[model samples]
Target: MKSFYIKIKSFFHSIEDNIAFYPALLSFLGFNFAMLMLYLEDKGISAFVIEHAPPLVINNADTAKTLLSFLTGGIISIMVFSFSMVMVLLNQASSNFSPRVLPGLISKRNHQYVLGMYLATILYNTFTLVGINPKETDKYQLPGFSVLIGIALTVLCFFSFLYFIHSISKSIQVNSILEGIYSKAKTRMIRLIEKEKKESPSFPDTSDWKEYGSKETGYLQTFAAANLINICKENDLQLKIIPIPGAFVLKEIPIIKASKAIDKELVEEILSNFNFAQGEIVDDNYALAFKQITEIGIKAMSPGINDPGTAINTIDYLTELFAIRLQKNDDTIITNEDKSLIYINTINFSELMYQVMVSYRTYCKHDMTCVQKLFIMIKYLLLQQTNNDHYHNSLISEAKYLYDDATANVENEEDKRRIEQLYKSLPNKRE
Candidate 1:
C-alpha cells in the first residue's frame, strides 16, 4: 500500500513537472468559466447586468459578434506566432547551448502562464461569439457582459504577449541561463542542508546484503526515500540503493542491496517506488545542474562554437556551485522519525569534482584562456577549504591535468609560459 501511494505521488509529480500541465489546467478552468457565463446569460443574468451596470457600446449582438470575431482571429494569429517564437528559441538554445538546458527553458512558469492566458482568451471569445443571438426577439441570449469580459481578457492577453516577448528574450541570454542554474542548485543545496540538520536515525550496516536488480533500463530520475524508509522500518530491513538519482541502470542490474533476503513479491513492491525516465531533470537531481553547466561550457569551447568567453563564464558559475556544494553534506541516507532504514550511495566530493572539471579540462585544454580560467577556479576552490585534504588533492589533480594539456597542446611559448605561471601560483603545485 505504501509503494502504491508512492507510485501515485510519483505519477502526479511527473505530471506537475511537465511544461504543459499548468497551462492545460488553466485552459480547462477558463473553458468552464466561459460555459458558466453563457449559462448565466441564458438565465437573463446579462439583462440585469446591462440594466444596472455601466452601458457598453458593444451591448448589441451584431457588435459583440464583430468584436469577438476580430478577437478570435487576432488571438489565433498571436498564439501561432508565439508558439513559433518559442520553437525558434528552443531550437537555438539546443543548438547553441547544451541540450540538457532545454528542460529548464521549457519549464518556465511565465511562458506557461502566457500560453495558458492565450488559450483561455481564445476559448472565452469563441464561447462568447457562439452565445450571441442575432435574432430580433432573442435579446436575453446576447451576452453583452460576457463580450465585455472577453474584450478585457483580450487586452490582458495582448499585454501578456508583450511580457512574454521580453521574458523570453531575457531568458535566452547565456548569463541568465547560467545564473538561473546556479541559483536553483544553490537553493537545492540549502534545502538539503536544512533537512540534514533535522534529527535523523543512525545509519545501518549493510555489509552482508542480498543484491536486488532492476527490471527495466533507464535513467533513475527519482525514488521515494521516505516511503522506502517506512517500508524498511516495517519489515525490519536495511536497504542500500546502489545508484544515485541520475544514474542509468539496466535490466537485471543490482540497483539495491538488502540486509536480509526478501521474497520476490516484496522486492517487486519495493522497486515500484523508483521512477525511471529517458532524460535528466535538474529539479529532482541537483547534480544534473553541474552536469548541465559543464556541458554548456564544453559546448561553448568546441571548435565549431569557439567561444572561450562563454566557457570562462560557465566556469565562474560552476565554481560558485561547487563551493556551495562543498559546504553541505552529500545526500546519501534516509530514515524514519526514529531509525535509519535506507542508505543511498552517492558520488563523493572527489568523484563529483572530477566529473565536473575533467570535461572542461578535456574539451577546453587547447584554449589557453579557458585553461587559465580553470586554474583560477581550482585555486579559488582550494582557498575556500580548511582541512579537507582529499578535496584539495582533487583540485590539485585537476590543475595537474590542465598543466599537462597546456604543455602538450599550446605551441606558443608565451601562452605556455602564461599557463605555467597560473599553475605555479596554485598552492599545492607538484614538483
Candidate 2:
C-alpha cells in the first residue's frame, strides 16, 4: 500500500511538471467554452436563433423560444468571456506581478506565446458560439429569475476560476524547480568533466587545463572544487596526494614541528601510502614548509570573480603568512551540510560577480563595493550560511549608501539607523 501511494504521488508530480499538460490559457478558455455550450443546449436553447440575434440586444427576444435562446447565448458568452479574462489575469500574475509568483513560467517569449494562444482560443470559442446558433426556433424565453441566476453563476465561475489559478500558482513553486534543474544540470556537467579527467592521464602528462572564470563569485570555484573532488575520487587518490593539478606557490612557510613532520613521513613510508606530496618540513625556527603548501592550496582555491588576474592576485595573498587567516574556523566547518551550502554560496558569488561585471559595463558609475557586497550577501543566503559579522557589515555599508542617495527600498530613519549600526560593527576591509 505504501509503494502504491508513493507511485500515485510520483505520477501526480510528473503530471504537474509537464508544461504541455497545463495547456496554457487557451486550453482553459476552450474547455470553459465547451462547457458553456453544453449548459446552453441542456437548457433547451436553440443554437440557430442564438446565432442570428445580436448578442448585446437582450430585449429583442419576445417569444418564449427566442427569449430562452437569447438568455442561454448571452449567459454562455458572458461565462466564456468572464472565465477567459480571469485566466488572462491569473496568467499575467504567474508571469509577472511578483517575484513570489511563478516567474519561471513567464519569460517575455513565453508571455507572447501564451497571450496568442489565449486570444486564439477566445476567438475560436466566440466564432463557434456565433456560428452554431439557430436562425429560427420556437423558443420559450428564460424567465427573469432564470436569467438573473445565470448571470450570477457566470460571475461565480469567473471568480472561482481566478481563485483556482491563484491557488495553483502559490502551490507550484516554479522558480524553485527552475533553479534546482539548472543547479543539477551544472553539477552533472561538472561531474562529467571530472570523470573524463580521471579517465585521462595524470600529473606530468596533464591534459589541457581550461580556465573558467566569471564575475560571479561562486561560479567557477564551485565548479572547480566539485570537479576536483570527483577527479580525486575517481582516481582513488586523496587530495593530500595530489593537491590541485595546478597550484603555483609564491612563498614558503612553516607547517608543523620538525618532530611531528618526521614522524608523519616515517608512518607514511611504513604504511606504503604515498599520499603526502611533502610532509611538514621545519627548517628555520620561524616557519614550516607544509604550512606554506597548505597556504598555496587555499590560494589556488580562492575564486577570482570575473578575472583570472584577480584570482592570481588573491592566490598570491594566500601564501603561508595570510593563509592562516583563510583557514576555516572550526565553527565554520561544523557539518557536511555546511560544506554543501558553502559550495552553493560559492556558486552564487560567481554569478553575482558576473552580474556586477555586466552592471559595471552598463552603468560605469555604480559603486563596485556596494554591488559586490550585496551579491556577497546574496551568496551567503544561497549557501545557507550564517550572515556573519562580515556579511552583515558589508550589507549595512551598501544599504546606507543606497539609502543616503535616496535609492530603492530605503524609506525612513529607522532603516537608516539600523544600517548605520550594522556598518559600524562589521569589518570594512576584505581579506
TM-score of each: 0.92, 0.27
* TM-score between candidate 2 and the true structure: 0.27
lDDT (tens digit, per residue) of candidate 2 on 161-277? 455455445433433333322333344434443443333322221122221111111101112233333333434332221112112211222111111123344323212211121
lDDT of 2 at 226: 35
lDDT of 1 by residue, 1-431 (tens): 75667779887776665678878988898899999998887787878876776475255777778878998889889989999999999899999998889888888888999999989889888887877778845555578788888999999999999999999999999999998888888888778767767844567567778999999899998887767777788799888899887889999999999989899998987998888877777777788889999999899878789898999999999888888767666545776766667777777788899898779767877887788888888889888853346777778887887788778988999998898789889986667
Candidate 2: residue 115 Cα off by (Å): 5.5
- Model 1 root mean square deviation, Cα atoms: 2.3
lDDT of 2: 0.33
Maximum-lDDT candidate: 1
Where model 1 places Cα greater than 4 Å from the true spot, the runs are 1-7, 136-138, 199-207, 429-431
Error of 1 at 45 (Å): 2.2
Q: Say which candidate scores most in TM-score.
A: 1
